[model samples]
Target: MDIPQVISKQAAETGEMGQEYLATGKQVSMRRWEQAASEFGETHCREYETVGMLISGILELDLDGQTATLGAGDSWLVPEGAPHRYRIVEAVVAIEATSPPARFNNRDEPTSGEA
Candidate 1:
């Protein structure tokens, strides 16, 4: 499958937004997001590796029991099966890439509650 690039200028200006960029086989998926004062629910990738780069603003990442704040030019790697969560404390954009593309069982649902 051919994956397209995702841009987030609109999300950046508006505060909070997310987009999926590319997916190759089941090997990887790339995503982008612009967040403003939002918290991402805790989750885990059962069989994938995740890596992310903070393009702008600040991100509070909680991996397992360890917590860290990442800002512009910062990056992180989350090994497979790690329970993690993140929060956006400021208007920010980030590029995230995952190997063995994270399978979101509820991607099409309005919310996890609806699934």
Candidate 2:
């Protein structure tokens, strides 16, 4: 996929799920999730690894049938190809990074950084 070249933080690409801030290098993709507690997500088995930090709210991750609940200041690592699914237990704000970029990411063009 053609990851658009970016310089600094700008308006990121988002979908029905959440917003993502993509890097120009195409080596990483980051996103923030702020969903209502009523929201539920399907199972996911990603091709890339992920490292994430829980900034606020609540989240429940089901990794191959093992469930774990996370809150503010908590962090986690999801290995590539791990089957996992999660739900927003409370309105959440989490920051996550994906290696080799995420296939779900979308971008129109790069703009000036948010810095």
Candidate 3:
């Protein structure tokens, strides 16, 4: 079995995915987006599947034309290769977990063009 690890908020790896902080393991990864307000109109189709929760503030998620408004205590999922986009209705602090390690081999990077 693997050893236990602890990562504090200040110790998270930062500077990817627009100032988000990340804690990554072999099979999965978690990222914290604090007060993020950029990329509101850009749509992206990621290579990894993600499950996320809004810790605070408001967000609008558009998944392949269907839209949902997310507030504190809300959670969401985006399947791999699913085209999606986010609009920040308010400054957002959120946490997301990705399978297959989204940061591995630059999987977290945005695709070449809009989805």
**What C-alpha lDDT values do all the predictions have?**
0.67, 0.70, 0.83
| Candidate 1 least-lDDT 10 residues | 106-115
What is the full ranking by lDDT, best candidate first? 3, 2, 1
Candidate 3 TM-score versus the reference: 0.88
Candidate 1 per-residue lDDT over residues 1-115, each given as its tens digit: 6676454644332211345454434567677776677776645444568788999999888888788999999999988767777878887888878776643543322332221
| Candidate 1 global lDDT | 0.67
Model 3, residue pairs in steric clash: none
Model 3 whole-model lDDT (C-alpha atoms): 0.83
Give TM per candidate. Answer: 0.67, 0.73, 0.88
Q: Over the stretch 2-71, how does candidate 3's per-residue lDDT look in tens digits? A: 7766788777677555645566788898888876664467778888899999999999999988999999
Query: Per-residue CA lDDT of candidate 2, range 1-113, in tens?
Result: 76566534456666544555555355777766666785445666776788899999989888878889999999988887787777789888888888867644432122122
Model 1 clashing residue pairs (backbone): 27-100
lDDT of 2 at 13: 60
Please report the candidate that would top lDDT against the real structure.
3
